[model samples]
Target: MTLPAVLRSAAYPYRANSLNLFRLILAAAVLFAHSWYIAGRGTGPSLQGENLGGWAVAGFFVLSGFLITRSRLRSTPGDYLLHRVARIYPAFVVVLVVTAAVFAPIALLVETGSLQGYLTTPVTPLQYMWGNLPLEIQHYNIGATLQSVPYPGAWNGSLWTLFYEFLCYLVVWVLGFLAVVRRSPVVVGALFLVSVAVYAALGVAQRGGLDESFALFARLLPFFLGGSAVFYLVERWGTNLIFGVASLAAAVGLIAAIPHWGGQVAAPCLAYGLLSLSAVIPQPGWIAKNDISYGFYIYAWPVQQLTVLFGGAQWGMIVYLAITVVVTAAFAWLSWVLVERPVMLAIRERRAKGSTRSEQLPGDIQPAAGT
Candidate 1:
């Protein structure tokens, strides 16, 4: 086929796109952005006042909003909640525990040469697990474990984002429950515009009675909504070469021109731009099938912290980053294979069985054994 025909084709399977690879790249971006801090080098890079990790996170939220909105729409409320909970919670809890028990203790013993008062320390291992189990990171360090590092006292900087990410999920849940997402495009569009307007009016900071976290949420909301808008917008207009080019151009222009609010404003277009790219970009078969991005993300900061403790950062940026990636990827793989995948697979198996039973119902229920 011709280039024009290829560009026009939306033949990429929407359900099985390489968006996971996009997410993996974003995850890697976060690690790269954080490397400077881990290496005691300071902030790595920035654009439009947001760092690489920040932009990657926005991409994450945007992609999540698109996919999660789609998931919510097709699923029952119970199923939606269950799927969301299962997808995020298990790995999260496991990570919290592993950090407190495994990573923190190792750091503590290396730092002080003993775990002698480890359990009773403020934000103890138990505290770390229980404190963050609710999906909010109430404590950063576990027992003075990170005092000697450059970015001291923070065991895991990455986990904090998970809180906001899950909050975004809850927002979708509420919208789904209210039937707002299904009712009208006008309402959702207007809501998105209003959010953008507020974000533009507020800039990067928040005012009024809104607490910091909620204010931060307001800032992030536009990206999520922008992603949601993409789902509907794409459903209505479809993705093609012209659409892809136009959106990509719009994304670049808006993100570059708008300042402070550019990312939030250009979010839908950015998401679509990436989606278009994903269609053309082929991910490896391994990564395409198993999504270890979440695993990669959750473990990166802590793994970097561990690396720093072990003097890995002294090897310079390239070596440090390679070590962090290699170690974190292993942890991510374990988390995926051992924790995340099993829960999700179980959920799928349960769903399949339920579907089978439902299909075999009414007549198939026929009074059991000749009753």
Candidate 2:
């Protein structure tokens, strides 16, 4: 199909687009973005006070909004919830368990030179495993792990966003249940407006400085809603070359002119740019086959921290990033093949069987002819 034709379709997100590659790149960007901080280099480069990691994460949220909203619309609540759980939990739980039980203890022993202390610590295996699972509002730092690193004592910096990502999933579920998502342009437009208002208020409040939390929800929700709006109205406001170029220009102009609220102001345009770029960009077949992005995202920070622990943070970002990327990508590949893909396939098979059973006619059994 032509690029414009692809963009105009509501089904485009589910089709063969470069979105998978985009996600992989974004995941890599997050790893790269964290290289400096985790290596204790500096705060790192940012746009409008948000780092590359932050921007990449925001892009993730936008893409999630577009795709997940479409998913919710196509599914019943039970199916939707099941899909969400299947997508998120299997790999996540395994990682948490492995990290808590094996890696944390090893790190603690290595750093503190006391297996006894690691075993006896209050924040050891049980606490770390259980607390981090179910919800991420628990101890982010395991006891004495990576404490000697220049960044000092943070185990998984990438995990904090998972909490919010899950929260966004819940938000989409609730909106879908409420029939708000059905309203499409109207509801999504209003949501975008509300997000903008909240963002503006927070920006004014934090004019002197920018806290990651201060305008986070305000900033992210709009991008997400923008994506939703695009999906809902793609047939009417379809992506074309002219539209894509214009939107990109608009985003650039807005950001350059109004750095404080430019991202929010240009969110719709940004969403359009992302969607168009993904649609138009040519990618290799393998880009769509093995999706290791999620694994990379969840695994990169700890690997980077380990790199700092072994190599020392004073090593340039080049060495740290090189080591971290290689290790993390290996782990990510294993995660996709071993854990994620298998679990997802199992869930889909179960759902298909359940659907088949449900479709059977009741009381359709035949009696014996002789009787």
Candidate 3:
């Protein structure tokens, strides 16, 4: 089966193309934010503004929750796990290996003054490779020494978000399973709220109230619940203009408040509301039809880091930015073609075979009669 056929048969109601495009645009926003930080532009006045990239990460969490929940609603637990693993881990492993074996060495060589110094340093090539191994399982900052030595001091700084994303996936899977067994949204919501509170408290105690851990958990849990709520609302009330307008308003209010309200509280709220609105609104654009946002999100950081390593910090920020864009676009294209497409095809084939086998089975098959 082709991609189009799989999409057409998908049980979810929203348009994939539109969501994908939104994700890509958010990813670009993230890249720009990171670039600004790297260039020493600070969070002062600029065309793109400061720290908008953090908002983009917020958007990603909400989007992930919305889409992943949508898929879970239509799949068995086994199938859902299969799809999620295929979507995430393969690219993750590939990037981890490349960053460890290829990028880390090149980055070290570029930044260090002497080969002897590089070798003699405690954080040697072997140490760097070992550190990247923890990254495969989401333990970052293990062997990092300096924040800027190799650009993020680790293979990929952006990967920190993936750990949270995977955690969100596990949360959704468990909640979804419980919901299916008990058929109670209230129970699921309660459980989610408690988890968020505990996560928030732990984050605050561990890193003080200033750290991202509390903020991230606080922000993301609501967004995930918001997506689940959207699904519930749509199912119960049906998609209509009134609810659509409310969701749109909520989204707009959230976005407009992001810069002022601060990322700690405002960003996740905005992302959740916007994604909720997006689920209801009709996608109507060429860009929406061919969205590649997730692809852009996961690939842009490493590409930028690599550029910084090779091109030198003295190189113009604009030049580095342009190079990052070009390289990231190429990577995004490849990810869509090689990683996402094949996995999706395999999913479709498996589903089709399962359906066929079930159809072939008879209710009254008399195995004892041996006909």
Q: TM-score of predicted model 3?
A: 0.71
Model 2: residue 23 alpha-carbon error in angstroms: 0.6
- lDDT, candidate 2, at 341: 78
Candidate 3, run of 10 with poorest lDDT: 362-371
lDDT of 2: 0.69
Q: Rate the local accuracy (lDDT) of all candidates.
A: 0.77, 0.69, 0.54
Tens-place lDDT digits, model 2, residues 205-291: 577687765455566677677766666766355556557777878977887788667777777777777877776786678757777
The TM-scores of all predictions, comma-separated, are 0.90, 0.85, 0.71
Candidate 1: TM-score? 0.90
For this target, which candidate reaches the highest TM-score against the unseen true structure? 1
Candidate 1 lDDT, tens digit per residue, 204-317?
345565566776677788887888888787666556656767887997798889887888888888878777777667888998767778888989999999899999999899
By lDDT: ranked, best first: 1, 2, 3
lDDT of 3 by residue, 247-331 (tens): 5565556545654323323323443445444545555574453334556666776677767656544577677778888788788
**Considering only N, C-alpha and C atoms within 3 Å, which residue pairs clash in candidate 2?**
none
**Model 3 segments more than 4 A misplaced:** 1-17, 44-50, 112-152, 179-184, 192-219, 238-291, 312-319, 355-371
Clashes of 2: 0
Clashes of each: 0, 0, 1
